[model samples]
Target: MYHVVIGVDDDVEHALACVQGVTNLPGDAAEKEVTLVHSFTDNPSGASATQIHSVREASEYLEDHGIDYDVNESSGDPAEVIIDFAEEEDADLIVTAGRKRSPAGKALFGSVTQSVILNTDRPVMVTGTARGSE
Candidate 1:
């Protein structure tokens, strides 16, 4: 099975965008597994991946399209947790949503998306934020 780790935050639209990216992956392969990985900087409420609104929305989208998915959650550094989870799962592709930064944003520490791309040896797909999707 081709495995993908989609790292999502609390942004619902960005989560959907990542889901769209997964669906757009080029392959006729029969078995595909999507791992919706969410990392919390700190969770006083002790939340799980499925509890996050974005993950739930993304899960719905995946379900509608007949794709198999699982939820994974971790605490502490978002990028580190995401990278660790991807490695643990032996993910074929790692997907992260665009941070929607302005042109004037910092060139360094571009958030989890940039960190994941730079650190991971596996392929990383940075899905852009939804612009005009209805």
Candidate 2:
């Protein structure tokens, strides 16, 4: 049984879709424990009521799936928090939704998915299309 950790943004639908994708994997490779992690940037203004609501919605989705999971709300860089949490939990795999970025943005700010892929020892699965690309 693998411990699956998924990084969730405030978007509940996308987060749930990521969770479903991981859990729906066939055969004995299915995850036994799933953890949903949401990180807020250090900017105080970034932490809004909307984030809490999204966390609640993600929690409810886990319950609906009959899958047990822990919700983590932290303050820091998103990529760092996700990697740290996965390491702390000794997760076998990390799943996350990939945000599409503009050519300029991609050149300026490196993608979090790339960072995690390079830094983590465990497997990382990136879902969704790039920000603008479907």
Q: Which residue runs does candidate 1 get wrong by more than 4 Å?
A: 28-30, 107-109, 131-134
lDDT minimum window of 10 residues, candidate 2:
125-134
Cα lDDT of candidate 1 equals: 0.85
Clashes of each: 0, 2
lDDT of 2 by residue, 27-76 (tens): 34334677888887655566653357656765676667666777777877
Candidate 2 global CA lDDT score: 0.73
User: lDDT score, residue 33, model 1?
Assistant: 86
| Runs off by more than 4 Å, candidate 2 | 27-31, 42-51, 129-134
- What is each predicted model's overall lDDT from 0 to 1? 0.85, 0.73
Candidate 2 residue-wise lDDT at 107: 82
lDDT of 1 by residue, 26-127 (tens): 763246789998888878888787889999999998888778998988787888988998898889999999776765674644678888988989999888
> Which structure among the candidates has the greatest TM-score?
1
